[model samples]
Target: MFNQLISFLDKGKIRKIARSHRAERYVKKFSTYNHVVVMLFTVFEGYHSIREIVLGLLANAHKLQHLGINYVVKRSTLSEANERRISTVFEEIYQDVYNRHQRAFSGQPFKQ
Candidate 1:
């Protein structure tokens, strides 16, 4: 499921944005889209916490493998990751993504 979602994440663009992080200690291996960034997006979009995200992932873990997000970080892992890193970076990334999505759909209309 989310593995297919991972395929939709532009790896190079993510890596490029990731490079601006000044804190190397918080830097993670970017092999998947199931990270703090996505976690924040999920929360900002109304998911209450990491538990919800984990549950969603668990319900579709098998599908994630096919999408290439094979790393199965639990709720605890996600919470810890989000906590350790500063929130501003995650905010900026999510904001950029949100803006892009808005732009992409700016002139969209109903097809039905």
Candidate 2:
């Protein structure tokens, strides 16, 4: 189910956006893609805190592999990524998705 929902996201486009924003600069193990995946997981699972998000991911480690999440995200890692990464990258992605599906949403084409 999670995998299916993430299928709507274009990984190539995500990487492109990350590059444009330099979101991966100085990054080590955690990439922008991983960050995005972890955030989506947190929201979908209704995790109220960073501790719960970490534990939840750790608990479902085996299942998350199919989602391309290989390592368990540490609380610090998630917190730091949320702070350092440019929020505009996500805004651009959201706008892209919204524009692409705006007609379906409003029954009319989106205006620029």
Candidate 3:
């Protein structure tokens, strides 16, 4: 299920955006895509802390491989990425995603 949802994301587009934002500059193992994946996992699972996200990923390390996650992220790595990465990269990605899917949402009515 998670893998299917992740498939909706275009990895190339993500890398292109990251490049434009220089989000991957000076990065070694952890790339912008990896950070995005980890953050999404954290949100979907309702994880409350860096420690929980790390441990959760660690526990599901085997399954994550199918999702293109080659390794278990450390708490410090996640923390550092969150602190240093440009927020605009994510904002642009969100806008692109919304634009691509806007037609599906066009007919829906919203309630205040």
Error of 1 at 17 (Å): 2.1
lDDT of each: 0.54, 0.84, 0.82
| TM-score for each candidate, following the candidate numbering | 0.59, 0.86, 0.88
Q: How many backbone clashes does candidate 1 have?
A: 4
lDDT leader: 2
lDDT of residue 37 for candidate 3: 85
lDDT for 83 in candidate 1 is: 63
What's the TM for model 3?
A: 0.88
Which has the higher lDDT value, candidate number 1 or candidate number 3? Answer: 3
Pairs with backbone N, CA or C atoms under 3 Å apart (clashes), candidate 2: none
RMSD of candidate 1 to true structure, Å: 6.0
Which lDDT value does model 1 have at 85? 59
Expressed as tens digits, the lDDT of each residue in 35-111 for candidate 1 is 64356346544677677777766775665555546666766656666666566655655555556555454576423
- What lDDT is reached at residue 10 by model 2? 74
* Residue ranges of candidate 1 with Cα displaced over 4 Å: 1-8, 23-32, 36-46, 95-103, 107-112
lDDT of 3: 0.82
